[model samples]
Target: MADIVEVRNKQVIFKDYINGYATGSDMVVTSDATIRLELPKNDDSLILTKNIYLSCDPYMRNRMNRTMEGNYIDSFTPGSPIVGYGVSRVLESSHPKFKKGDLIWGLVGWEEYSLIKDTRTFIKIQVTDVPLSCYTGILGMTGLTAYVGFHEICSPKKGETVFVSSASGAVGQIVGQLAKLFGCYVVGSAGSKAKVDLLKNKFGFDDAFNYKEEQDLNAALKRYFPNGIDMYFDNVGGKMLDEVLRNMRVHGRIAACGMISQYNLDKPQGNYNLLMLIMKRIRMEGFLVFDYYHSYPKFLEMILPLIHEGKITYVEDIVIGLENAPAALIGLFNGTNVGKQVVAITNE
Candidate 1:
């Protein structure tokens, strides 16, 4: 057994339940917390981890609300550290499946070190050739999200016309690439010109537009997909969704991955195009990635090769320290990060 080691642990704590959008002030980052780098005596189920990288996801915004409605996860406690997907190096472990020095990714606290009791959410890292940070986004939850949401939920067909909202984001970028690989004609929308360029030039989307510049989203969709959209991978909901519904082809499929547009609002804007679903015979479905985690091995098998062979590309907007996590997370809502936002607590 390794000697018990105690160290100062820096943590990003959730200050309180919030209303509307979140800001850096809603969280407190401090190094006052400390932890013993060992599992509690005789506890065979607990795992001690040194968090290496933490993921900043837009869905975390809803979890900060005082009252979580229809959310799969619970709201963060007022005085505790925020928890999210992260990659960590195991320092000590009592669980039969893990051991000291093993790397894993799943739900972890926003801290330098986390004592993980729940192993159900954790998955051991088998491949180390890629950047470990990839586990926080591409090789982890967001990658799986793009795969399942597009391939399974969207039920995409080759040569079909597809549109992805927030196409420059972690999930959206991958979704667009997957659609293209599946022999579909893809168009994407992002918030900035650089992101739009990235979609067309980097990810090989057929076309991309800056959504913020479009006065009428309906017109933009019409210009891109004159034949009407066959599949819609929706990340930004609200207005975009309503417009897309009007432009969808008959028998179209919509995968409702997220509603980032409505997260900060007190009352979510309603989509007024419910009638379009009926008129077009659309199949729109909302999915939580947790439900499809059972197929993670299959997802990795498909994604890893594409990544290595250069068929797929992933970009990350990584911040260097835990102290900067609040700003990194807050930036997700304001369109600040250009790609997957990750906070690197330490290099392993």
Candidate 2:
């Protein structure tokens, strides 16, 4: 029998259920935990994995809340390591589908090593031409969310005017690019001039603006979409959604992908312009990415070629070490990350 190997696992523990915005101090990183780098006896379904790269996304803020009453996903336990999407290499596995040395991406704990029992959601990495880190953002959940939201939900048409909020971020960036590629007139809004430039110049958005500099968001939308918006890919909900409701054209479609602006608030902001939906015959729909996992293979087929052909662009803001994961995650709320925020645990 092979001698068992034991390794120390560093984990980012959630200090407590947060009441307001989360800070770096809210999570405590400890190196005291140790685990055997092999599957346990009698556990045929367990997979022991060494997490390689972790994704820090805006949706994670909701899981930090004490109660996830109406949320689709469960809240993170206060004393345990937080969990999110990540790429991992299997160290040991008793499962029939996965073996030692297999690379996969799915939900993983915020730790150096994780003992995963459920492999249903995990996906094997088949494409090697792109960086493995892209599995965390562009080629993973973020990419699928953009594809499903725009292609499936919005039902975009050629020559349509599409506007994406938070357009320099992970999902938004892809949405804007797809819209531009689909022959739609695409415009985007970001928080900073740098992000604005990235959306316009890097992502090929027809136009882009800094939302922070705009005193009146309604006027900003009008300046970009003088006629009216045919479709709106909303990322920041709150006031932006309210302003967008008034600018939507008749029979316009709105894909509510995320509401990052209202995630940390004690009481979420309400949209008062909802009446416009009825008046303008607009269809505003909210969707969860979990509902569309079945279409991932279809998404992969479309995106992989675009990536290889240099028809699309993906940017990642990666921080070295798992210890810096907390800061990288918190940076999302303030627009500190220019693109997809990723944490690299180890290259091995």
Best by lDDT: 1
Candidate 1 per-residue lDDT, tens place, 283-304, comes to: 9999989999998999999999
Tens digits of per-residue lDDT for model 2 on 191-275?
9999999998899999999999999999999999999999999999999999999999999999999999999899888989989
lDDT of 1: 0.94
Overall lDDT per candidate, in order of appearance: 0.94, 0.94
How much does each candidate deviate from the true structure in C-alpha RMSD? 1.2, 1.0
TM-score (all chains, Cα) for each model:
0.98, 0.98
